[model samples]
Target: MHLLGRKSKKMAPLFLALVVSLMTFALAVPAIQLNAQKLGEGSTTIQSPAGKGAVNFVLDNNNPDNLIGVTVSFNETLPAGSIIYVKLYNGGTLVTSASKQLTADLSAGSGIEIDFTSAVPISDFDRVAVVVKGPTIQP
Candidate 1:
């Protein structure tokens, strides 16, 4: 019994260190919040004059890589200074985005391809959103 007591005393410092290490690890790890709501799906109503047609998010054919670009066809020509915004989402979390402002008018029924800089791993994101903002009207 005395020998066992002596062994335990020798192990005390090591046991305390292990406990401290575990506590440190637990503190270093980030906690996932269950209550917080993540931004998910978004829906927008398209008016009559301007309509969003077929959209394809695929790998660029000209510069084939792991990255992807968007090919969109609009019903009508988009005006100059119009802005196009593309967003990639993995579940509710936004993965990446790209925005480009039109320098000239886009012709109707022409498939326009918009590229995203630094876009990679085309398979990672599941949701793709595209928004086009027309040039402001002057009174």
Candidate 2:
């Protein structure tokens, strides 16, 4: 099946676009941390920053409103050409996904924030995952 169930055709393009963007980030980079929550709030970091895997997280927005663009921050410096894929899921259905390519090497102890351009704003308790992978080995 496609990214989501066979429903609205209009949304299919948006979903595909997110996946297609993620596909370009298929570069080799080191394992890093991901923080999709706002500052001063509870931790939202993705665990197991060593191997290529998906980390599940919950949006910690207490406000009674759908989360608009989300900024995901990385804890470590990925290589100059690393790919990152962020997916947000509402229950079992995939809400939206985004990908980013690092133009410069991320320094250690540094963080990179990303904005999600989803058709629907993310909500609290929504499940989120981040998969970091690459085309080759890190330098």
Task: Show the colliding residue pairs in model 1.
Answer: none
Evaluated at residue 95, the lDDT of candidate 1 is 86
Model 1, runs deviating above 4 Å = 1-49, 58-65
lDDT tens digits by residue: candidate 1, 18-101: 999999999999988788675445866645434866677667566665666787778898888888788888999998888777
Clashes of 2: 2
lDDT of 2: 0.59
| Candidate 1 C-alpha error for residue 50, in Å | 2.7
Colliding residue pairs in candidate 2: 27-134, 77-106
